[model samples]
Target: MGTPVAKIGLVPCSGEALPAGTVCRLACRRVLDTLMSGQTVAICLPLFIAGGEEERGFAARHPTITVDGCEKRCAAKATELFSGKPVRALLIPDILAQRGIPMPTRLRGFGAEEEAAVQAVAETIAQAVEGVVAQAQAQENQHGAV
Candidate 1:
């Protein structure tokens, strides 16, 4: 059989109080469910923090990308603390600011602006996943050649 493919873990912030947090979750969902699909797996921040062995194990074994709502970087910090440093960390607010998109206000009242933010973030995550997978494959190939 062929070697197993590498999967990237996605850790999304669990801050429900902030609209950016909602964007983080939605964007991750898009990446996991559609954008990257089988290439990525979702790691629940709360479960990881609460000592979920499965979540921690996955992060430790695979490359992880953390998506934070704000500068607090709760997801990134937790993943680093429990497992190892994430391969890539993304901040929703920073992405929106860089794109000149305003921060979302209401969590429930999502509109075109929110959709745009989600699309941008999801695309970014998908790109990151591709990078991580490519790097992993390169390393595997190098080692196999030895």
Candidate 2:
């Protein structure tokens, strides 16, 4: 096989697409936008929905940023299982659960309240990534000045 390309990946778990809901996609986009503000996020497009070939392609390239819409945490688990420690992870259900936002059997996108929940999750993940980057930078600075 050829050497994997290096890119930044965005992954989301939407719990098997529903009739006409776009919560997962929208939330994923928000997360991507936030991450993109700090780093390059290669548009991998729905990594959790892809199959073996596509999955391998994504895993082979890009440091992954995974976002899951449920407790199942499919995106994060897949990232850990195949790709190793994801650069970033957002657990949507965990975030919502923490905020006492119950998941409806059928989601019709997020309301203002739910949107806040999603933003909180994404922001938390973004902050974590920023922290990691800061630590890496600190280490680099120390080494460079040595």
Candidate 3:
């Protein structure tokens, strides 16, 4: 009857171990940016196995877009294991690897360079989610008119 609603989410594979300090916080900011633009987004910080389980449940009920900082695939695996819904995983390491963005040898907090890196990765993930939402809306329009 109306536009198809899309609930988006971003999740990191490892929270505490993230060399980029407050990377999850940065991810939250990216989600906020989407919401500011009149899009809906949910962010779940899975600090432990139990939290991951909860996130998986939330993702199951909604079409969630998960983003991980590395190749650990923790976020995607958790979402799939708990919710049985496969996530559109945005592995930061994979992206950086593709762009030839060098990896930091030492783990540290979010700095200027790391911030920019995360921003790029986060934006890429957001764009993909937007596309999916748009496609779903288009399909709804097509079906409703028929």
Candidate 4:
């Protein structure tokens, strides 16, 4: 309720089905804290999907970045279904592949390598957040001019 619409919404995949899901969640937090700081807010995947209308309404009106744990893309799919718009989707495995890093297998504890992977995912998300903010600013500026 305290979250503001001006902040970019980060919807991380809530799939407990795999370790990749955990990766996305952790990476989302890292990006929010280090990269976005006060510029972003998280829309919990579980809550956003079946929680309340306020969240859905907020996502519909604001820019959202969906971080998917895998190809299923639960977060991205939910965002598009509820918000009626495509989000800036970042897939964790794909990010790692792009950097030529191997995917982690363990599901629980984040070891050194896992943490590094999370950082990589967070970095990619950070870059996307910058673009989202820039585009939002441009849209506001354009509307203000009109």
Candidate 5:
């Protein structure tokens, strides 16, 4: 199949109420700024939740991943409410717990453990982006890119 490059949108929780939320933000930044800069972009959750037409329009076209902080899944819920379904959903707390990484209680007092969690989460997100892009391209090629 021919290579069909696809844009990926990352919507981070960006919640300041909890440290997991902060980790969500940092992990997304790692993806957008370092891991998948060329293939992915960050979608502002504040504006998206506020019904920003541009963000909504972007989601309509690209595959989006919702990076949530806790089990509440605010980011994922908001995205689903405004736009269509997200291609994938990530939870920082869940990831950290699954990886056996302990997290800080405060929102801004993260140390090395938090950093490590962010790194792990970012790597997973990057890999997910590649898979989504590749699958989209294969599907497009099969369907003749209508």
Candidate 6:
């Protein structure tokens, strides 16, 4: 039988105080539900931090991408602390700042600006997932060739 494809875990920020946190969650949802779909799995930050064995075990087995809302990097830090280091880490504020997009202010309601941010972040996550998958496939091929 052929080797099974590896899945990438997505860990999004859980902070509700900042609107950027909302963007992180929304963007990750878009990637999980639409953009990357079956290629990715969502890792709940709260559950991971709270010692969810299943969550931690999946993260430990698969590559992970952590999306953080701010500089605190709670998601990234927690994932690293519990399950090795993540394959990729993304910060929404840095992405927005680099792209000249302002942070969304509304926490619950999303406007055009928020939607744009979500799209951008989702695209970024998709790209990261693609890279991780490609690298894994290459490594698998190389090992199979041996």
**Superposed Cα deviation of residue 51, candidate 4 (Å):** 3.4
Rank order (by lDDT, best first): 6, 1, 5, 4, 3, 2
- CA lDDT, every model vs. true structure: 0.87, 0.58, 0.61, 0.81, 0.83, 0.88
Clashes of each: 0, 1, 2, 0, 0, 0
| TM values, all candidates | 0.92, 0.63, 0.75, 0.88, 0.88, 0.93
Model 2 alpha-carbon miss at residue 111, Å: 3.9
Stretches of candidate 6 exceeding 4 Å from the true structure: 1-5
| RMSD (Cα, Å) of model 3 | 3.4
Taking the tens digit of each residue's C-alpha lDDT, what string does model 3 give over 14-93? 45566532454465566567533455455464533555655656566666666666666676777776665544667777
Better of 2 and 4 by lDDT: 4
Q: Which candidate tops TM-score?
A: 6
lDDT of 6 at 74: 96
- Candidate 2 residue-wise lDDT, 1-146, digit = tens: 22322345666665566311244556556656765454535334344345555665665465566777666677778777765667677776666678775544445645664565556566665665565556556766777688
TM-score of 2: 0.63
Off by over 4 Å in 3: 1-3, 20-25, 34-37, 45-57, 105-108
| Candidate 5 residue pairs in clash (backbone atoms < 3 Å) | none
Worst 10 residues of 6 by lDDT: 1-10
| Two-way lDDT contest, 5 vs 6, winner | 6
Report the C-alpha lDDT of model 1 over 1-146, residue by residue, as the tens digit: 22445688999994899988888888899999999998999998888757799999999888899999988899999999999999999888888888888878887677776798889889988998998888878877887888
By lDDT, the better pick of 1 and 6 is 6
Residue 81, candidate 5: Cα error in Å is 0.8
| 2-116 per-residue lDDT for model 4 (tens digits) | 2223788888885687888878878888877877888788887677657668789778878888989888888888888888564588888899999987777878788897887
> Model 2 Cα RMSD, Å?
5.2
Winner of 3 and 6 under TM-score: 6
